[model samples]
Target: MTMSKTRSEGSLPVVSLPLPVDVTAPAVARQAVRATLGGLGLDGPEVDDVLLATSELVTNAFEHGEKPDRLEVEYSDGRLTLRVFDSGTSRPKLKEPSPMAARSRGLQLVHALSDDWGHELCSGGKYVWAVFSLARADASA
Candidate 1:
C-alpha cells in the first residue's frame, strides 16, 4: 500500500452516528469504523490503521468529551472519516507523545494514523473526526 501526502483541497465524506453516551465504547466504534471502511472498499493494514485510530479517537471522546452514544462515521471518495460527537463544548487536540505515561495516547495515535483529522462545533455539541485514505481494492482477475 502507498501512503500519499494529502492535497490542499478535499470534500466531506462522513457517517454521523448519534449514539447514547457510553463510557469508552471502543467495540461499537470499531464495528462502525470497520463497516464504514469495508463499504468503501479498503482492506489490509490500512484498514487496521483506520480502525485503530477510530477506536482511539472514540475512546478520547468518551473519556474527555463525556459523550458516548454520539459517535458517527463518514466515508466517501477513498476517505473513511470517523466522527464522535458529544454534548461537551471542548474541542479535540493532539498532545506530544509521552513514553513514560501509562495513558494519554489517544490523540497521539489518531494524529499518527490518520491523513488528517480535526474537530467541529455542531448544533448541540462538538464532533471530532479522523480521516484515513482508503486502500486500493484488488480486482478479481
Candidate 2:
C-alpha cells in the first residue's frame, strides 16, 4: 500500500505501508504502526492490542500466505486496516488443531481482537484484512 491516495469523504484517512514480506519486516512494521498511531495519542494497551493483532496476521501471512513483496496496512481516521498480499487467494480458516498444537493461534487471536476481518481476491493475488475501531482504542487509552 502507498500513501499517494487520499480516502474519500467520511471514509477514513489512509496511510499505506509497502514493505517486503520478510521475517523482520513484520516486527519492524509493527513498530512503525505503533509510532504512527501513538502519535495520535492512543494509549499503551490499545497500541499493544493493535500491535499484537498485526503481528498475528503478519505471522500467518508468513507462515501460510505466499510471501508476497509487500504488506499493505491502511490506517485511516477511525479504523486501522491490514492487507497482506499472497500469490493466490487462499481463504484461511481456523482449524481446531490437536488441543496441544503449538502453532495454530493466528486466526484465533485475530478473531478475538479485531472488530471485523476478511479477505478480498484481487487481480493477481489476495488481501486479507482486519479493521479495528479507534474509538475503542481511545477510550481504553
lDDT of each structure?
0.70, 0.69
TM per prediction: 0.78, 0.79
- Model 2, span 1-141: residue lDDT tens: 233333542443445566566787678668767765766555556667788887887777777877654555565566767776666668889766677888898888888888888888887777778888775355455
Tell me how far the alpha carbon of residue 112 in candidate 1 is from the true structure, in angstroms, after superposition. 0.7
Weakest lDDT window of 10 consecutive positions for candidate 2: 1-10
Q: Model 2, 21: alpha-carbon shift in Å?
A: 3.2
- TM-score, candidate 2, is 0.79
lDDT of 1 by residue, 1-141 (tens): 111223222443445555545653677667766765676566889888877887787778788875664665655565666677777788777787677989998888888898988998888778888877774484332
Q: Residue 117, candidate 1: how far off, in angstroms? A: 1.1
How many clashes (backbone atoms < 3 Å, residues ≥3 apart in a chain or on different chains) does model 2 have?
1
> In candidate 1, which residue ranges exceed 4 Å CA deviation?
1-14, 136-141
